[model samples]
Target chain A: MIDFIFHFTMIAAMIIFGLIAIEHKNLIYSAISLAVMSVFLGIIYFILNAPYVAVFQLVIYAGAVTVLFLAAISLVTKAKGEEED
Target chain B: MLPLNLLWWYLGAAAALYVIGLYALVSTRNMIKTVIAIEILIDGAHLNFIAFAATPTAGIDPIAHSIVITSIIIGGCIAAIALSLAINAYKHYGTIDIKKLRRLRE
Candidate 1:
């Protein structure tokens, strides 16, 4: 029962965060939401008993991918004065 | 094997993810949002793969797990490339909105 509860909760959170990631108007906020959703996805993998996949999901999606998105957002949105840098 | 009930639950969640991602892809005009929609779609497929691999009769299939890992790596690469392209597009067009970009092109 506890496992079921945890599984269901994580799955629900993943879906909610995914929606927020795509629907949020601000690009930075959308990237953060994607990271949060990825975290929940890692937890889901753990629940499914794929520890290795969970670790990859956390490290790649939550860590590397989020950083990449944030970097892209910052690069693309810099002020006019900062564009020369 | 995972209980039939649990399997159904996981499958349903995967389907929901697919639908959400598809809706976002179709409705969103922002380049970054389109990339995000793609990530969500890939994640949905990963969930489907993992859900099916959860059979108890045999421990989690090593082959399937490896495939999922490979897919994850590929998905990361795709996101990086797509974001780079989006950044380049923004540099050239001064906006990330696809509609604006189309107008600028014409």
Candidate 2:
């Protein structure tokens, strides 16, 4: 019974976060939401008995990837102001 | 007294999420949204692999877990490349919308 509940909860969290990541209009907000979603997914992976994946998801995704995205966003925004004709 | 048939239920749900992710990838025009949809699709694939790994099959499939890890890294690389391209497009054309980007095809 507990396993079933955990499974359902993880699915629900994934769906909710996936939707939120795409539905937001602001790109930065969407990226932040994606980071939050990734963290939640890591927790779910731990619950599912995949501790290595959970750790990888947290470190690679929430840590490295999210920072990379933010850097890209900042670079783009800076370039946007310079390109105006 | 718990239903063993619930395994099928989880599989079906994972499939449904995969389809939804595919639809989002197909229908979105924004580059960021497309990337996020791809992530969703990858997540669905991982779920399926993990689900099968949990089952009592002929043998243990550690390969699936390894594949999922490899795919996640690949997906991150793809996302980075895609975002960089999108940034370049925005810089050159001043927009990230795919519909607007078609003007450059001439």
Candidate 3:
């Protein structure tokens, strides 16, 4: 069935991206990978017929949480000369 | 006929994710990675909840869905507060390395 195929593919992708987020050295890359994994998870939710959960996952997680992560990364990794601003 | 064993797919994936998240939490040195791992662990648990609620014969449970919705809001709050705490820790220590964070030694 089409649903089965889609579900399997997304699940595989999710596993890889999640692992990459955990194993990456750079914090920013890890955050980016986490966002990608979240998107895949959202799609899985959609496929599983939980539209509300999927939408919230994309909006709250892929949007707000990733932004929060980048903001924290930015604050912590500030350049020396840019401190005046 | 669709195989009845399909539920195992979701459950297996959830178990694998939880294990990976636990490994990340234990092995990673960075605070941000730890936070991400925690999020992953919560997501795995969320998947398990939904998987059970989604069974065809058992019928969808609105109650489980409502609980998951609340958990999402709470998880978001936890992530925000944890990241802010990490920011403060970075400011105080100049680095997030846990090994260098011993204040009582100095």
Candidate 4:
């Protein structure tokens, strides 16, 4: 029962955040939502007993990937008075 | 192997993710959003892989975990390259809209 609840919650969160990430107008908000989704994905991985994979998801996807998105957003948005698309 | 009910549950989640990702990819015109859609698609695949790796007798398979890790790294690299390309395109064209790159074809 507990496992089922955990799975349901994580999957729901992943889906919701994923939609927010893709559909959000602001790139920063989208990127942050993606990070949140990644974190939930890592939790799901951990529940599935893939600890190493979970760590990598948290570190690579949630941490490094989000940072990359933020950097790119800032660079592009700030360049030559380029506005957000 | 996971029970039939559990297997379907996992598969359903994965499929939902796939659909969401594909919808975003097809509908969005922004370059960054396209990249994000790709990431979501990869994640859906990863979830499928993990779901199938679960076995009643042996627990989670180690090979599947390794595959997912490798995939995550590759996805990151792909995102970085794509973002850099998008940035370069923005620098040159002053716009991130995919529809505005007609000069590239000409």
Best by DockQ: 4
Question: Worst lDDT window (10 residues) for model 3 chain A?
Answer: A76-85
What TM-score does structure 3 among the candidates reach?
0.90
Give the higher-lDDT candidate: 3 or 4: 4
Candidate 1's TM-score reads 0.92
Ranking by lDDT: 1, 4, 3, 2
- DockQ preference between candidates 1 and 2, better one: 1
User: Which residues of candidate 3, in runs, are more than 4 Å off?
Assistant: A78-85, B1-3, B102-106
Write model 3 residue lDDT over A1-85, tens digit each, in one string. 8868877898889889999989987778989999999899888777666778888888888889999999998888756542210
DockQ of 4: 0.66
Q: Report per-candidate DockQ.
A: 0.51, 0.35, 0.41, 0.66
**What is model 2's native contact fraction?**
0.28
**Candidate 3, residue B5: lDDT:** 69
For residues A1-85, what per-residue lDDT tens digits would candidate 2 score against the true structure?
8878876786677667767777776668867877887887777666555677778878877777777777776666543444211
Candidate 4: tens digits of C-alpha lDDT, residues B1-106: 5665776787888898888899998998888988999999999999888877774655678999899999999999999999999899889987778877765657
Candidate 4 lDDT over residue span A1-85, tens digit each: 8867877888899999999999898999999999999999999887777889999999999999999999988877753544544
Q: How well does candidate 1 reproduce the true complex, by DockQ?
A: 0.51
lDDT of each: 0.89, 0.72, 0.81, 0.87
Clashing pairs in 2: none
User: What does fnat come to for each candidate?
Assistant: 0.72, 0.28, 0.44, 0.65
